[model samples]
Target: MLLNQLIKELITKMGDDELIIGHRNSEWTGLGPIMEEDIAFSSMAQDKIGHSWALYRILHEELGGEDPDQFAFMRSEKEFKCCHLTEMPIGSYDFSLMRHFLFDHAETVRYNSMLQSSFLPLQQLARKVRGELKYHTLHADAWIIQLCRAGEESYLKMQTALDNCFQLACGIFEAGPDDKLLADEKVYPGEEALYGQWIENIYPVLVKASLNVPERKEPVYGGRYGKHTAYLQPLLNEMGEVFRLNPEATW
Candidate 1:
């Protein structure tokens, strides 16, 4: 039962992260810089939302949690455990692109590690999610490399975006008390190990793009425990507005 608590906490954080980022990505639906990017972002947003729904279902069916819709849409700000990186508003194109790159890489590594989890449900889901994330990262990498090497203006923009988002990106690896327990149980490697893997995974891409990886600093934390930015509640309010009116209604 205690192990179930650990698994529930991990998946809840993952689902919330996916839900919030999907909302952010979908904001680019009509605002993308190009038609191709517009379509790609929309597709990726759908994928993230679907991933979140699947995670919530695993929680509900296997871990004794609420229904997926209720669990995702009805949670208050304080109840969410997503990291601060995912909670921030999608800023400029460069910022959003950089975020997509950094966040997806981290997610891919984490899910890849989860392939070995002792938790059977998560292990199975991880296999499927990892397959999807391959395309997500490939898109992110192509765009990042193309833009960063395109010219001085685009290069500078990406560099600045990377600098601005680095700290927040670091926050994605925020550790929890149960991390060690989960690691010991082979639920997944601890966040710190996953964090290291993420760094290695992303470093070469940045290097190839001629973008300087920002130096490590104090990672903005607290979101995992429900401490979030001012931007999150507004996003949540908008996200839940439709559902809040009639949460019990089947859609």
Candidate 2:
């Protein structure tokens, strides 16, 4: 694949991941265990969605892609490249917290690596996203540590959530056919390398929190190639319910 093609694929996948996870986080709007948590998760949801919009804008302006809103909300299920990890519903507070911890760390590392991208647009955007992610990881780390240390009950829940999410979290690093082009061209580090850094970054926090990182296993794949779980299509339909009614209608 050409370099621009590779960049577009990588960026679109990142954008999709951010957008889906934002939606998942938003599901906690009024249902959080506490009011403060409800507000916090809602804030993070906006951040993630905004991050996705910024990335999609880069795709549109720098990579000759479609308009950001149409490309994001109007795409079919098979056109989305988000990982299965992001598609899973926010089952419980524990699951959502654990997912946030795992996924945000991966996102942090990925954007940090992108700071050095040969592609200037991505490099600039990554720097901005990386700043926002700093607060995200901070929120995640504080909660993970607090909950893990609250008591045996909280600790056990966190451990179980970690166990449940580990494999799916690994899917964030699913390798793609064009990854080498990005790696070789310095547009971004390949997923494997970013995965390693993510592990390293999160391991210390888990250790400090007295939690066990789940044992290594096969990473879920196929999302990058348009494969997704049953939940995604429904999500798209709901997300686009208003948009599809009149694509050009001004709010």
Candidate 3:
């Protein structure tokens, strides 16, 4: 495929992931475990959602006229291209922390690769995203290490969170069929290869944190191809109910 076609495909998929995950993270406002963490979570959530809005705007105007919020809140779960990782709930400090840990690492790798992409538009978007990603990773890393070094209970909890979430971790690396074209265009790395790098980047953090990684099945891909986890439906229902109810209502 031509490089522009490939970069266009890849950017669209990447935009979907960023948008949905950002929406999910925004749910953390006022819901975090404590005051400090609450501020932190909300701050990061805002950043992510802002990034999503920017990316989605590109997808909306340039790619097609898909409204950002509607494309986000109205789509069926199966139509959603987001990975399983973002679909999961914000559970305990452990679960949420693990969630952040996994995603931050993946985003770090994902953005860094795109920063050097051959696709001009993609490279520009990636450079903007790169502004916040390193800070996110550093924050997640500190929390993971802190939790791990605290003791057996913290370690166990972190382990459980990691074990449960790692399956979805692979989803970040599972692009749709157009993935190869995107890589060939240098818009982004392919899913399987990017995932290999994610493992290498994440493993040391887990090891230093004193947490044991779990055995997991091979990735069940399809999100980018329109398949979704069970969790996405309810989320969509809620996100869209009001939109549907008041499609023409001015508020």
Candidate 4:
């Protein structure tokens, strides 16, 4: 693929991930274990979707992609690049919390790496995104530590959540075919490097929480190439339902 095309793909993938996960976060709107958590997840959901809109605008305005609304809502399931971790149903509170911790840290590492991207648009956006992600990660880390330290039951639940989510979390870094070319051009550091940084970034937090980081597990891949779980199609359906009803309607 041409460098421009690869850049579009990269941005599209990131936007799709954010949009889907943001919707998932919104699912907790009134359903959080606590009122504070309800608001927190809802706020994070808005931030994530706003980030996606910014990314999609980069694609449309800078890269000749379609309108952000049509591109996001009208695409088929197989066309989306969101990882399975984002597609999975928000399970129990433990699972949702763990997923939030893992996913947000991975996002933080990626945005930080993009702080110097050769792509000027992404680099500029990264400056703004890094600030927002700081609080996202802080919230995630604080909750993780507090929950784990609460008691033996809470500790074990968090540990189990970590073990269950680690592999899926690793899927967030599924390598792209153009990763090397992008890396060589300094568009952004490739997935392998980002993956390493993610592990290093999250390791201390997990250790502090007394949670065991699952070792040597294979990352669940295929999301980047459009292979998704059964969960995704339904999510896409529900997400785009309103838009599908009236694509030409102004929001």
Query: How far off is residue 105 in model 4, in Å?
Result: 0.7
Task: Compose the digit string of candidate 1's lDDT tens values, residues 219-248.
Answer: 889998999999999999999999999988
Candidate 4, superposed: residue stretches over 4 Å from native: none
For candidate 1, give the lDDT of residue 152: 100
Q: What local distance difference test score does each model get?
A: 0.93, 0.91, 0.76, 0.92
TM-score-superior candidate, 1 or 3: 1
* TM-score pick, better of 2 and 3: 2
Candidate 3: tens digits of C-alpha lDDT, residues 1-251: 36545554565566666666666776877877778888887788878777777767777776664787777666666666677787777667788888898988988888788778776665787788776888888989999999888888888888899887888777777756677776775667787777888889988988898788766587656776777777778877876787898666766
Worst 10 residues of 3 by lDDT: 1-10
Clash pairs of candidate 4?
none
- TM-score for all predictions? 0.98, 0.97, 0.89, 0.98
Our model 3 lands, by Cα RMSD against the true structure, at 2.3
- Stretch of 10 with least lDDT, candidate 4: 210-219
Clashes of each: 0, 0, 1, 0
Error of 1 at 89 (Å): 1.3
| Candidate 4 lDDT | 0.92
- Winner on lDDT between 1 and 3 is 1
